[model samples]
Target: MRGTHPSRRLGAGLLTAGLISLGLLPVPAQAAADTNLALGRAATAGGANGGYPASNVTDGSQQSYWEGPLGSFPQWVQVDLGTQVDL
Candidate 1:
């Protein structure tokens, strides 16, 4: 579980430490939080090729496909998230 629940997290941490101290549980390795900030976010492209729009990338329709403007070198694609997010 995530650490969002403080009371439960504190209890778990205390229990884990106690167990490790008593040699009942081994110390765990560190790991990064697996959070996907881009899920469901909008995408905007500099241009579109025919009917392929940038929105196709995140439209929730896995079958949809996107193609940036043809022959446009180094096109600009941006994610228009409504709020600031930590990468």
Candidate 2:
């Protein structure tokens, strides 16, 4: 019976480890908003007419986040209630 060379076996092990590590990588949260809810408009910076309110815009704020192309993709807003709360 033939067996894989020591180097080949090591390479395979490394490859498996790499794949597992990649899979374990943390994934960013993704969000989607309804058209009628004005979520889509806010994603594009087009909701400046106080649709959602200027003070409500979080964008680069520490609480809310907006990602991806200027117009494409959904806006991501992460909210913390200071503590867990049931809605």
Candidate 3:
């Protein structure tokens, strides 16, 4: 009540209740933080096709994709996470 708008508080509580009832809320998630661990990290690849550097994969954009040189078999790309993390 103090420093709080009644309607706003009610609206928030109602929304939370609705989401929970609809099963849209994942309460008490037992997992690591949902995040892109490799975004903007240092990356290295066997090779690239023109502008598609190894960093493209870790740039966090689906539209932009990395490509290996043509006719290259078993191409590989590596991203450094700066530290070990749970997969």
Candidate 4:
């Protein structure tokens, strides 16, 4: 009991496909950038008492954790945009 037919169906299908194809564009171009500074400062003498590294220490110790051996860990940690991605 179909009515108007295959021609109408074909036209509708093509239109739908075209619209969907056009929708597949608009991603970030510049990308995103994130980095961890990884800072560490030694604990103030025995103030650390007994706890995590000076960096994670929650006590009120004068000794703080600052950046540690740069080479030992990721130094400048960076994220390049690589290439301008198409959106």
lDDT of each: 0.76, 0.46, 0.88, 0.43
Model 1, position 80: C-alpha lDDT score? 68
Alpha-carbon deviation at 50 in model 1, angstroms: 1.1
In terms of lDDT, the poorest run of 10 residues in model 2 is 31-40
Question: Model 4's lDDT to the true fold?
Answer: 0.43
For model 4, the superposed segments whose C-alpha errors exceed 4 Å read: 24-87
lDDT of 3 at 81: 90
Question: What digit string (tens of lDDT, one per residue) describes model 3 on residues 1-87?
Answer: 568889999999999989987879876543435678889999999999999999899988889989999999899999889988875
Q: Candidate 3: misplaced stretches above 4 Å?
A: 1-33
Query: Which residue runs does candidate 2 get wrong by more than 4 Å?
Result: 24-87
Better candidate by TM-score, 2 or 4: 2
Poorest stretch of ten by lDDT in candidate 1:
29-38
Model 4, range 1-87, lDDT digits (tens) per residue?
A: 859889999998898778766865443433332432222323332223234343443233446533333335342222233445553
Q: What digit string (tens of lDDT, one per residue) describes model 2 on residues 14-81?
A: 98778767875443333222222323233334233323433354334456443333464453443332
**What is the TM-score (0 to 1) of candidate 1?**
0.47
Error of 2 at 65 (Å): 46
For residue 4, model 2's alpha carbon misses the true position, in angstroms, by: 1.5
Model 4 vs. true fold: TM: 0.25
Please state the error at residue 22 of candidate 2 in Å: 0.5
